[model samples]
Target chain A: MSVLLEARGVCRSFGGLDVTRDVNFKLVSGDRVALIGPNGAGKTTLVNLITGDIAPSRGQFWMGDDDITGLSIPERVRRGLVRTFQTTRLFANLTVADNVALAIMQRKRISRRIFSSATELPEVKAEWSEILAHLGLDHLAYRKVIELAYGQQRLIELAIGLALHPKVLLLDEPAAGVPHDEAPKILDAINRLPADIAVLMIEHDMDLVFKFARRVLVLAAGRLIFEGSPADVTADHEVRRAYLGSYADARHSA
Target chain B: MSDITMIHAPQKRVPFAQEAAGALTILALGAVGYFLYPDDLAFLTRLIGIAFLVLSLDLVTGYCGVATLGHAAQFGVGAYAAGIACIRGVTDPVALLGVGLVAGTIMGLISGALITRFRGLPQLVLSIAVGQLVAGLANKLSWLTGGSDGLSGIEPGKVFGVFGFDMYSRTGYLFSLAVLVITFVVLQRFVRSPFGLMCRGIKDDDLRAKMIGVSIYPRLVAMYGVAGAVAGIGGALTAISTGVVGLDSVSFERSAEVLVMLVLGGAGHLWGALAGTVIFMIFEHVVAAANPFHWMTMVGLLLILIVVFAPRGLIAPVMSLWTKMTRKGKAA
Candidate 1:
């Protein structure tokens, strides 16, 4: 599989402290990569850098060979590089369908239409309904997002990401605050995404990371400590010492 | 299967019915105003003009979530543009409105650019500054704008070159009402469109809207321009009806009053703006006439009651009631 996204020497600093120190990684098509890091490891900051939410103090991002270091957030999105928020940032007052429809409309370049009703647009309706259905969220389509349960709201965020037609999707802790029972639903939704897209998920729950990602990149103290398959991740010395000592030992004994 | 089909369900006819109802209400209002306040046509006409200004404010402050207190800048510019055009021999009423529309649009774009750059308190301050600056400029250019005394001698020709603006203010009132209705209809379509939905999204959360690949700054600027156009028409209506343009049109007080009217009626709802304008003006007229000394106290009480009882503005409760009644009817 070809690389869909690449981060070369990505570094960011808050004040004089380096948050992301010389981070490097590649997300190839069909890749399921989980970025595992302890709190304040600059995981979200790295996602922000890639998504153009915050500029990197130093480094470059490549989208399928095109250097997208200076592109605007919307420009990066247009090029099929998208990111979700750590905390679900949705149009809360709008309906679930509207939240999804806005993304689809932007993708279709029809968000600027003044004469046509958004809900009545045949193309937009078809795509949003299909997205919601794929994510098993059709029932919540007309309901305002503010009224939805937290788990369902997470699903809507995924639905929006799907609507953007991203080739490289950066999910910033997609299951952060979800109730235990509803987390599997989110995983199911993630599993159902198109096979051609590359997904980079930032998750703290090791079980979730192992279940969802084939490859794991461990970030510790602003540096990548380990990069390997889940099976090998637990075997790495630095990764164990830095992040997963007890969990890694427990997994090996089990 | 039943669930998926809902997406493909025939386009909801509810909004259309609602639109029809709103249009009829406006027409009915015009008729009632015409007959009930025959002598107060000039005042009624003035209310219609302010109605446009409030609606324009809603587009920016309500829909786009751009807090502005200087919308009167656009209105004043439009009024001055139309008044000056008329004085300079662009005697046609429609042509004068066109001039006002252009002037308002330009002002909207200018203000939108400056305001959209900041958020929260700074945005409000910037808006107030823009309004004050425009008002100051209008005052300073007394030679051109007629300054403190106001610009006079604006003689608007007949509507369609046949129906002259009568001394009894019959034609002026009718013309303003007709234009108001047309503007309302067009705006209804505008606010329901995809663009309008996007603006609503921006209002709800700009960062989410931006992350969804929407270039929010431009959308806001565009909305401001549209708001400007609406306010411009309102200003032009005032200029043509009253045959005078004053600094009060662009003053800080005018902007604050329009904002108050919007909050009173419901910001974000077009009909709310109209209702607010009508209710506030008429209430002011009657109360001030009855107790000119303590009229402010009554208006303050009314505002407090509305805020305490109907925080979403006067229109929201009525809307909910209508929805509840309609839903009950369908269930039965």
Candidate 2:
């Protein structure tokens, strides 16, 4: 498969201590990958490096054939690489429809005209509705984001990322902080995404990783200890010792 | 009609009614001013022009979240540009406004470069410094700027080649009102557009805006420049109506006063700026005339009361309430 994103020799350090030390990964089109780790394993730091929120001390990241190491957050997003945060972030004052519409506007690269009713434009509204439907969030489309429940907000966050028409998506704990019954909604919403867009999910929920991702990469103390399928990871003794411990059975229960 | 048709119909008509209401409100205010106090017409007109400045301030501060307190810099620059143009033989008021627009654009571009580099308190301090710098230069340039006394003998010619600005205050008042209306329409249209929506989103959350592929700095700079034109037009009107450009036009005090008026009316909505200006000016006039010694105290008390009761500005809550009532009515 052709790679859509690559992080080669990536390293991030804060002051004297290293958070990510020479981590490398390649995400190809249509690939389903889960990046799993114990807490404080540099998952968020790595995501920040690839998204250009914080520049890497030493590394090169790529989007398709282009080297995107020097690009800003918006510049990277323009290249069809998008992500969602662990804590859902949205335009709190605006309605859900406006939030998705703004994302659509970004993806289309339309001239943000200063004398037209863009929030209700026919094509933009259509795309917004579709995104809301994909996440089962159409009922709350016209409501302000601040009024929504945490689970609903999480779904809206994913809808916003999808609105960008991303080539490769990095979801930082998509189901984190959501209610028990609402986890399936998040999973189902993620499962409905198009096949051509590769997804890299950073999730603590072992059941979700094993159920959703075809391949898994394990990180412990800023090092990649294992990379394989769910079955291989379950059987690997090092994976059990370093990270999973006794939680491996949770994958089979699903 | 079906339920769907009824629902869609109201949604479609809301914008049309809203647009008409703004224009009609301007006309109503002008008509009321014409008959109510022909003597205070110039003061009333000046208030409207200054309202334009407050509205412009709202664009960045209220919507785009660029905190600033030196907006009067743009206003003063526009006034000086207009005054200089009239001295240089361009006596037409229309041409003078064009000069102010250019001057304001230049001021915005230069200041925006410095101001947009930082945010929150740092941005506010930079803006304040820029204001002081401009005022100091205007005061120091004695020969060109007339120093602290300001530029005098600015003679704006007949507006539209027919309306002569006589001593009676008819032409100047109408001209100011007309400028206010036109700028308000343009701004109202702009803030409701797709670009405006994005700016609001940025105001709500800048980090999220960046992640959504918004090139924020350039958009903010552009908004600042556009806002400059509005503030500049306001300054030009003051120059024309008063027949002199004073250092007070760009004073930090004037900036603070306009900010107060904006916050009083509500900073985010265009209508709130206008409402705040009218209320603030009228109350000040009444209190100063009745009890000159305690007028400032009364005004301070009035502001405290407003802040305590209607913190969102006096206008936004009303607008929101109106929306709520309409929605409830429809549901019933």
Candidate 3:
């Protein structure tokens, strides 16, 4: 598969401490990749570097063939490189639909229209409904995001990310704080995403990473230590020792 | 795919009916003021002009969530632009207003560039700093700006060369009211548009807004420019009608006072600005005259009362009450 998003020799450090160093990876089209590591393994930092939340210390990355090392976060998003927060950041005061509608509007480039009501636009309404329905959140579309459960908010975070029409989506722990029962909602939503877009998820739940990502990359001390299939990741002794800690499921899967 | 039917809420429709009614009320108030208290019309006109400043302040501070108190920088620039134009052989009201608009827009862009780059306390402090800087410059430029003594003798010609700017300020009041209404309507339209929605999103969460692909800085800059132009119109009106532009017009005190009005009215809702300014000004007018010595105390007490009773601003409680009443009417 051809690479859609590539991070080449990406490095980030603060106060002489490296958060990510010489981290290189490629997200090919339709790639379902898992980025897993122990605490402070720089998973989120890598995502931020790609999404332009923070500039890389010394490296260049690419969106397809276009070098986007200097683009702003919004500019990167406009170029189809999108990300979600670990804690699922959202416009808590806005309605679920407004949250989704805004991304769709930005994607459609109609967000700059100074006289057109986005909610009143039939196309916006339809797209909002469609995205909501995809996440099974159509019923709660009008409810303020703060009113929803944390799990549902995560789904909304995903919905907003999906609304960007991303060519590469870097999900930073999409199910981090969600309860076990509610976590399935997120998994269900993720499972339903169209496969044409590349999705790289950083998840602690090994089961979810295994279930969702066909390929897994394990990071340790800001380096890409292991990259293989989910089954291969579980069996890799270095990955288990450095990050996974214990994979009782590894044996069962094998 | 499961069937998903959207539930249309009562407030889903455009607020045309309500806005129209509000516009009518404003027109009615102006008409009544024109007839009933013709002598007091000048004061009212001045309040309406300041209301434009408050309204524009509401846009950047209220809607876009760019914390600013130096908005008077733009207002002062607008006033000086109009005053200077008038002094330099452009006594035409429309033309002077145009100069004010351009000046205000430029000031907004400049100040907005600096202000939008910072957040929280720094933003507020920068706003105050910028406002003070402009006031200082205006005071220093005595020859051009007519400093310390203030810009004077700014005489605007008759309305379309017909109704003269009389001693009673009847033309000024009507003209200010007309400008206020038109600008308010346009602002209403701007806030209701998709770009307006983007501003709201940016206001609620600019970080997430950026992640979702809204160009936060440029949009904010544009909003500031538009808002500055609106405020410029107000500043120009003050210059043209009052025939003076003073350093006091763009002082830190004016900026703080306008911020208070916006907060008093309800920041997010556009009409709340007008409501806050009108209420504040009316209370000031009536109480200051009646009490004279303790008027500041009275205004302070009013501010305290508003904070205690309506933390969201005076407009919020009234709006909620109105919605409750209408919902009850529907159920009944």
What TM-score does model 2 score on chain A? Answer: 0.94
Tell me the whole-model lDDT of each prediction, alpha carbons only. 0.89, 0.86, 0.86
Per-residue lDDT tens digits of candidate 1, residues A56-120?
89989999879999999989999998888878999887789888988998999988999777766
Off by over 4 Å in 3: A244-254, B1-19, B325-332
- Candidate 2, TM-score vs. the true structure? 0.95
Residue range A62-96, candidate 2, lDDT tens digits: 88789999999999999988999999889987888
Model 3 / residue B260 / CA error / Å: 1.0
Residue-by-residue lDDT tens digits, candidate 3, B94-178: 8888999999999999999999988999988998899999999999999999889999998888777887797789899999998
Q: Which model is ahead, 1 or 2, in terms of lDDT?
A: 1
At residue B260, candidate 1 shows an lDDT of 88
Q: Scoring each candidate complex against the real one, what DockQ results?
A: 0.53, 0.53, 0.51
Docking class of 1: medium
Worst 10 residues of 3 chain A by lDDT: A243-252
**lDDT for each residue of candidate 2 in B287-306, tens digit (9 for 90 to 100):** 99999999989989989999
Model 1: how far residue A97 lies from native, Å: 1.1
For model 2, name the residue pairs that clash: none
